[model samples]
Target: MVATVDVRHETLRRLKSGTGKLATAALRELDADYRWFGELPAQERSWVGTVAQAGITSFVSWYANPTGTYRGALEIFAAAPPELTRSVSLQHTLSIVRTVVKVVEDNADELAAVGGEAHLREAILRYSREVAFSAAEVYARAAETRGAWDARLEALVIDALVRGEVDDDLPSRAAALGWKPGPTLVVVGRTHGPLGETQSAELRRSMRRAATGAMVGIHGEDLIVIARSDQDLRELASSIMESFGPGPVVIGPPAVTLLEVARSARAAFAGVVAAPAWSLSPRPVLADDLLPERVLVGDTGARDRLISIAYDPIVRAGGSLQETVATFLDCGRSLELSARTMFVHANTVRYRLKKVSELTGWDVLSTRDAHVLETAFALGRLRDAGRASL
Candidate 1:
């Protein structure tokens, strides 16, 4: 027993004296073996060197008392900045551990007592295994922290959009979250009740699978998703429609890039407000499709757009279309009555209606399009009358 104790003491003494050399040797191995090691920024590389030195020093202390607690493995990583966990991946860390162990093993015979090389090699293996596990814990904790921070940042960006308070920082903040210049759109809908972490993560994963990039935010009962994709925005919205709660899912118009995403988000938010007005609207409805409802709810932008789309074009066609449409709508949409009121052939009235649909893209024959056209024409006439009075 005394002989074994003396050998152990002798081995520990040598390991303590050579910790610096072992660390340097391990770093050399890293530089020689790993291409990524040299590519790390200078500060990060310095941090990695600190970590390697910490590991060797800790291992020597653990060797001094083999039966002591194994906290040294964890303390080794504490020597470096936390950001090192991100710069050096878990795989690269394990490689570092292996290289350090190999360095110690190569010198074991020289460092150990006359008969202690085998015991020194075993200690290296055991200590390396503990360090490997510690590295994993460090990386896992870093990932959790990073994920939490990203979630908060995403919520902030989404809130800014919902409130129409976007600034120049929005694009930069979004870029930090991996959003780039690309076709993007916003979707507003009800969330699936309340989401726990697991469900929220799954929903996010599902959305990402459907688009090139996706960010989600939950405000009260609302689920807002901003997605970028090479695919059509409408198709991307449809693919993720089932992820929302049982309510209308309104898709904003696509933005050319993240810098313009606020416009899309604002339109989507407006659509969500106006969607309830259209009770029979599709689950994934376009914000533009709700123009009439949006106009009814005091959206001046929608009112102007509706007039431009449905009324101005018919007047611009200049074939007596405005009078014919107003007369036909006033005559209960009856061709004969319209023709009689206008003193024209019924076919003439029919031909004018066709031209109205062709020019305005709103068919007077359909109930929905007819209401849109009627509302737009009335709004347009009201605006003109106000201007004339002015």
Candidate 2:
């Protein structure tokens, strides 16, 4: 009993220190040192002693007067004795302390309402500081875990490839590791906080869910995922959009080998740059043979000029100048087939051909002009594809 009393007193002290005025006032009013069990009539004293001895009176007071301003105290005289046993006997004493603590927590607003501003502010500042310290500790632990997981994941990927555990599409294997070669897709996702240790675990889970069978790596602030199978690439990308909110996703056209993944990644990166104004709606953009073309167009600006020429109102009103050029090129420079493919009387094709020559100041009939236009068209298509991906 003495041990239980000491523990109860200590616990109440902690609760009082942790809380505000209501809990402290309730504890003071309990007058725990007084023993009135033997003084009153048998029935009345029986109820009063039970409440006082059980520590229930203090609990009731704390719970009822949470802000320490209630005019009436709680009356638990008629309540029956709480069940007690050897194991939980100490708990009965602690229950009073817990009750006080709970009242303080639940009535923080009430305390503030009752003009406990200084006390409330001090409590809030202390709680905030504790939470901040705990969060920093958690972040540090996560960072350490992430570093170990990264190394393990990298080794796992390299070992799987070397042991022939993966299928013979070596390019796909290379692409997953951010290597530059083969058909590839690059996906970027935002994390909850600055990159730390748990990110690798979260990433691995995401990759497994995407089922891309690709090697995933983190480069600075970006998540770089590579995969060889176009189907897997598409599925992985779709899953990422669903799991994380849409941002930017880019898929590069199939390359011949793993050495081309870097080129594909660069193309995808460029795509992300082109459409800064456009937002993704959970969709991924695909660029096939257009990647190289886009690079050329972006580097040289000639592709834009070609588009202006092809779609210009003056060119279209006269006749489709670009279509005529396409037919001419497809016919291997054979004027007869070019005229037939145009679906116009050879005389009409000839006249439109004349008009194209006059407007562009280049003879569509010339091999040099044909070559230049074809190259420009290819470049324009690639650039367009890349932009779509971004």
TM-scores, each model vs. reference:
0.89, 0.33
Give candidate 2's TM-score. 0.33
Expressed as tens digits, the lDDT of each residue in 182-283 for candidate 2 is 445555443333566676667766775565455665555445555545455566567666533335555644443544444445555555444343333224
TM-score for candidate 1? 0.89
Q: For candidate 1, lDDT tens digit of each residue in 156-222?
A: 8888877777788988888877788778878989987988888888888888788755888877678
As a whole number from 0 to 100, the lDDT of residue 96 in candidate 1 is 82
Instruction: Please estimate how well model 1 matches the true structure, expressed as its whole-model Cα lDDT.
Output: 0.84
**Which candidate comes out best when scored by lDDT?**
1
Q: Which stretches of candidate 1 lie over 4 Å from their true place?
A: 1-5, 66-73, 317-319
Q: Can you tell me which runs of candidate 2 are displaced by over 4 Å?
A: 1-185, 188-193, 228-232, 243-246, 277-282, 288-390
